[model samples]
Target: MHLKLIYSKKELYFLKSVFLSKVEHGGASQLCYAKHCKDVLDFSASLNPYPPDISWIPDMKLLLEYPDDSYYNLKKAIANTFGCPPEAVCVGNGSIEVIRTYFYATIEKNDFVRIDPHTFGEYSLSVQLAGGRCTVLDDVDSRVRIICNPNNPTGSILSSSELIEIARSLEESGKLLFIDEAFIDLADERQSMINKGISNVFVSRSLTKSFAVPGLRIGFGVGNPELIEKMEVIRPPWSVNAFAEDFAIKALENLDLLEKSCELIKKEKIWLYEQFERIGINYVPSAANYILLNIGADASLFSKKMLDKNIFVRDCTSFGLPRSIRVAVRTREENLILVEALEKCFQ
Candidate 1:
């Protein structure tokens, strides 16, 4: 028997539009690539290719017990790592979840949320889904502003003092400033606003990229105690699993490895840029671990061609860049493979 669902015109239109909307993201879509290619190299996702040595095995006791709903231990670890008071720390399943929860806690219906073009797409989607309107940075009427430091796709970054100035202005006007520092660790930690004691500014940090545990999905936010509490109220209990918290706690213990990885990425990034120069491809200078290359062709087609060579790179069309693609800093051997594959695309 077929059951027909009846809905008003407005409701039906909303449902249809939401269903039809495309969600674009970059990463090793292993299942999608496995069907068409063999021995695929993933340069699409910007993660620490040389991650700290950590065992995947989970403790049996933690596995059996339900995660702490408050995320007390995880929050403490993040606070200590960033030198912030534990009261100001909020842990989540990932930085994206933390961003969404912030919106849920702070954004009112019909409020104006400001975002920069070429930033992460999820910010706009989150605002629209919460019945808030999105505007660009130039819009002075926005009640909230979200900036991705070392922004995705472009890899441009703003200094800590510059961010503080923006935050101060917004605070004076009774507005909120949210900084997405997902890639900041790959750059400079000194530029982070996490432990700055800024009242109106909220900083979201991702453990997935720096810690190389995207599958585990751990992230955290630092802000005013009151704001952190508000987000916690709306966040689902035990959203961060037991294994993820324990894993993150362990990762934090090894700061030396994280530092070593950052130094290596810096060195490799310079080398990658030099390669791009020698190849005569236009590329954006980046402080983060990724670079954007203007391939002077259809980016989607170029990505597919590279995939045919068992190499994967991010198509920048989703970030409103149709002629460019983004690639991550990897080991020298892996990067040589990418360079060879990229050169073929020009042929």
Candidate 2:
């Protein structure tokens, strides 16, 4: 040895893997480059095109004071929204935060988790950071399983019955289940497993996508009271900001409004699919607001060209599909703009 090492080999390897993992997300970063381009359309982030009317102004006077750490009202609102008890709820800055907090609260050294291969990257990173090993391949022996319903970059959804069966099996084995339903509201609320009376399952959901306000960043998790309490302990005090909390609480009060938002997105998705077919583009059948397209070209280059034309789309390389892109279903006019841009790019 030339010299004594300052770090262990295992630590160095783990850090290297973390450094190389893809952490890129859509929507926000692309806005910076689009400032110079007019009429830029960001189709990268999946959000409802017809969010319910929200007209609440934050109390600026309350900015001087800290929010109630207990978040009693917010929890109650979430419980009512999801048909769960308040004691079963845990709130976080966002669904991603709730997910990470759940992993940290439950995972231990040498614990292994299984995750869906074509889903969110945060699940794997969060598991690793929590000192748990994770694998994408199906392993009956894996102690925990994580999945994203209406999965990202693919938009495929499993029915509630399918998920219930899986949860039952996991429970039989004394294993854990974590489900991410961030896109469930935008897809089919009937497919939700939120109130399924399952003890071993924890479900995390977000209002960011459904409310079309990712900037607000409010999300929650529901589980058995014991597990939810554990997550609450790990959740930072006042993780949800005062403004977001207020918006979430009020939004939950009018959950029925999401039905219209869902119906509109479903219709828009069909129209977009027809346009894709007309252009000879291959697309995945999606139940959510976003659809995955097989462009038969380099995803990075295609995404860059689309952005150059004031249209931004999510390149699926981060989701491990290098030749595909994910485009969010927006309003009719906006979707028509996207179709025009697609025709131009392909031709």
Candidate 3:
């Protein structure tokens, strides 16, 4: 008798996915590497440079008693922040969860939608997991459209007018529109679709990225009340940990902190862009917290080179742009290190 080993294609692909997740573990910030260097200015993640209000962690006993089943207060806070009704608000473990729930709620199996090229990969993955189809749209209309405002790698943002026109068209066509505004906090608030009052549109916002509370894993979505109700049905219970909820509540209470952080990012982003220009390296202008750059060729190779020098940046190979890299806007000193290093590399 002969025995044969069996293997499945999905299993094989899963193994690859795990191996090629991100340049760092979910793109960990450079600041965490204090052991390797005295100064770690991580421009890898677009987060609040200012720390949370508390000098230390808060107690979590109250939160452990199981989250508010209805999440009433949480929804109310979100509504207050967005100047909308509580019914128009929905909560999730993170914005990505809300994104997945939204797709699963409406998209029929095998239906196709258009997404930005080399944008966030999770959107496509979520569609596939829901057994739906994805078709890329090239500056053309004719398919359901999803976009990441101030997009992921390049950080390019679609103007409010353009997005409004697109949303109007999609609404008239009876198609779904999902816009991940997780990074839009880095820009002026008026540039967002939320200000335009567009319906049939879902905007997923996260405190994780903006408030540097990623460990809390709390995010919310604002959209049509009917659509949010649909997602709530599919959303799971206790998806948000207790401490995460508390963190969000406290963070939202401090409007001054939010404003200060946003202003700093905008200023630093401009300075960082000028640094890149002065260095004579190739980079795309960004409205978000990070900049996408070209490192000659083979970004993975360039990233490794930086890492060897105790510096790190995001290689865009995962986004299917191997020659480009994305780095967050960090402190002046850290930005200088990156600029000097890249100038050396180019020379």
Q: Candidate 3 residues 197-295, lDDT tens each? A: 777788888888877776778888988999889889899987877777777777767644666777777788788778777877789888887889987
Which tens-of-lDDT digit does each residue in 164-256 have in candidate 2? 999999999899999999999888889899989989999999999998888899989999899889888988888889889888898888778
Cα deviation at 134, candidate 3, in Å, is 1.1
- For model 3, which pairs clash? 43-328
TM-score of 3: 0.86
* Clash number for each model: 0, 0, 1
Better of 2 and 3 by TM-score: 2
- Model 1: per-residue Cα lDDT over 1-347, one tens digit each: 99998998656645754653445777776537375545789888899877878665788788788888988888888888878888998988898889889988888777899998987888887776666788885755887999999899888999999999999999999999999999987888778888776689999988899877788889889999999999999888999999899888888877557778888998898898888888888999998889999999999999999988888899999888999999999999999999999888867
Where in model 3 is the C-alpha error above 4 Å?
Answer: 1-26, 29-41, 51-57, 138-143
In model 1, the Cα lDDT at residue 312 comes to 87
Error of 3 at 14 (Å): 13
